[model samples]
Target: MSLHSLDVRQTALTLLRSGVRNAEVARKLNVPAGTIGYWKHMDRAKRGECPGRGSHDCPRCDGVPLDHAAYAYLLGLYLGDGHISHYSGHRTLTLMITLDDHWPGIQDEAEAALRSVFPTRGTCRVRVKGAHNIKVYSKHLPCLFPQHGPGRKHERLIALAPWQQEIVDEHPWSFVRGLIHSDGCRITNWTVRKGKRYEYPRYWFTNVSDDIRALFTDTLDRLGVAWTNCTRYGKPYNVSIARKESVALMDAHVGPKY
Candidate 1:
């Protein structure tokens, strides 16, 4: 429940709709600027209006120069564990990436990528059980992430746009890093032979989407990283990079999530 009166909140919304900045509205209403920003975000969400709709900052719409490396990494993250959803009437969209709490460092990197790609938009973190949902609202999320559509990503075809492919081509390691951070991991296995123990480090990428797995392997092939399909629990959904050379490459590039 809101502590502020309905009328006061409405006045703030009205002022906001009429071009008053969030800080000015906060001053006029004696509300905290952060509260005002929240109100504005919710109000815009309710009305199905993007907070910065029609602004000339969208990379696709405004021809803004995109940070290709950041975007490529983010794209991999999105493909691995990201989601985009529409609110109200589809005018506003929210992009969310659910990350495990065990890896706060990965969370920081994901947030940095989001900010680097969409520098002007605000990003927030919502805490859920055992994880965090890093969220950003925008009207142009679809433009940036065309893979967003109705139904589960694995249920639908996931293909990259030509430009996105170009970016991934230019920054394949970054893309692999994002994917690894999101839905993949590096693990060490030890074995004993002749009273000696040896440890083998390998990379595993697991995704239900065939296309996504293919994309990961394709990029690995381009990078000269050998990979193989591994079946676990009766499902062939894991891509394993256990070859010494490939593991070395992965260690040099993606490494284990800190």
Candidate 2:
């Protein structure tokens, strides 16, 4: 006979399905960790689902339809400020995107995009040192983000697959918005010309990776947005969009991060 009630078991299963760690669920429900583990094992057996392997509805692996716009945005965010790490002793991989805590809207958008990309999976937000990390776990993240490889992104060459290229081509604005949200920003610059003050808004994308900068500029070219390379402290480390028409287009689509 099971020591725990059916209600308790069901609650435990629900939390487990949402990717909550066993220890967390146990603490929340006031149950023993070993007991929770055993319950999870038995529940998987009952449902004929493989443990550790979990359930995957990956668009790449399972042949399901993908939200291309959401994915394009997520790809930008990933390329800008996201990373994937493998869970030790498990087949699961966790994807985390860090955003400034002050921009709650951007954080929310990031979370929504991640959920849209992985509707069947669960997501969590954690705060660390003035930033919020939106994280999700899946076994097939590698299948989706083939760009994931060893070493810092700036240290390696990054290229897009054919299918990813198609998505970015279709949803360039979303991609730009994601990149801007991650590593780019808009600011107003002022100057005095003929004793008259003039102010203009400009977009700046700074990344150490030449490949990533190329990707951003290439997308801008496709969108008819003009950009220039800017030097900071004697280093060419920024892409500046200051053309009036280009800034207008960016304002129409991306605007200032909020």
Candidate 3:
């Protein structure tokens, strides 16, 4: 086949495997619609795997190399409230993080974290459903989010892989930021004593998983951020950083959500 024909076939197959319709792929590539359909038919006859869909096959779809800060942040989001999934019959992977609709700058931050990891592929899309949610699509999500498996994260043994542990060791603060921003919050507290009122800022992270909570506390310890842990009656475990110095450290590193 001529180089031009080869390029067209490759592009056509990529678009098709991504679940794009033949007519749309034809329009995007300026090829005849029938040409795309024909190519897809031929490829199916050969029973070849889609370029980026199979396990550990395509280097391009193998998750991006772990960037210490970026991966650490992404890992936190995953452990906290994020979800990763591959819908039945779909070749694309979806990574979603839901945030409070009222939280300012959160969408921007989530998008930024995604872009940092994805860089090129997978456009991050935001939708509001009672809360602002960010979703990014990519075929490499399995590689990036290997922690995804059967059952809830709390029900599963959610331990970091060697690579993830290395990143967290180097950039614990970013990991903490992502975890806190998702499952934790920073707020001001008010108290009264002897006819006077005082206000203080505190940071707290709550989660049901013991392992995840341990990871959060360990990261805090590594950074020398003072924190206290407790379990509320019939509630998830809570970790609070209320000391002024520790809060200041967190503010310098993680800051408020957004």
Candidate 4:
């Protein structure tokens, strides 16, 4: 299973396309998962295939670009109507792209991308789990938004500010699996696991505590908020489009929202 030959790399790509995890393929090939990722990137770039690097310009292809809105909308579809994975409660979608971080400008980047390839069925939004280092993330990022400290972004209460909260109340997340965010400002190289504690910065509505938690949760509930959480990914509720609001708050106020 050595991944040294051209045949090995090609076989690995076939395996990945056939729904085999890189780890399993690597094990079968006896190569490292990173090796598989490396080869995949190399092969795609060499072939001149659009890398879908989280951008709206897949000018090479007329299909949907890998934008946040598209991703989020698909996830919501999965959550509301798609079958649950046999191994997981969360419905997951993965993309390999280059980035410097996974937040703040993400919605901006995503929204713009979505508008370019906008949907005719419905509005598109995004809710993702990111990691830190912004490098080669598979699922969740580690150490996302380090400047904000650590743990579920409890300090972001002000993000659900009154008017903003009002918007959430009005829209109420519906038919969408919640978006989970990680600390990765760029790309995620990791995912959550049993032994691994999620060090990525985040905020969640599922099981939110405090009367203040009630404030956020109740508003979302009244508005029909629905999101999903990976015991290993992000929070477990539908993500709100205050994608703009979250950005504004995080950008302007770095402390507890209140």
Q: Please, what is the TM-score per model?
A: 0.78, 0.78, 0.73, 0.21
Write the residue-wise lDDT of candidate 4 on 178-216 in tens digits. 222221111113356897844332333233323333444
lDDT of each: 0.88, 0.88, 0.76, 0.36
The digit string of per-residue lDDT tens for model 1 on 28-120 reads 888989788767766654443444445788888777778999999999999998998866544467999999999999999999999999998
- Ranking 1 against 3 by lDDT, winner: 1
What does the lDDT come to for candidate 3?
Answer: 0.76
Where does the lowest 10-residue lDDT sum fall in candidate 4? Answer: 138-147
Give the local distance difference test score of model 2.
Answer: 0.88
- CA displacement after TM-score superposition, residue 229 of candidate 4 (Å): 14
lDDT of 1: 0.88
TM-score attained by model 4? 0.21
lDDT tens per residue, model 3, 1-258: 223478778978988878998899989988877567657754642342233434443333554354568778878987897887656555456788887877658667777888777776555557677676678776556556667666788898778767678789998988998999889999999999998999999998999999999999988888999999766896768999999999999999888875
TM-score, predicted candidate 2 vs. hidden true structure: 0.78
lDDT of 3 at 94: 75
Q: Once superposed on the true structure, which residue ranges of model 1 sit more than 4 Å away at CA? A: 1-53, 88-91, 194-196
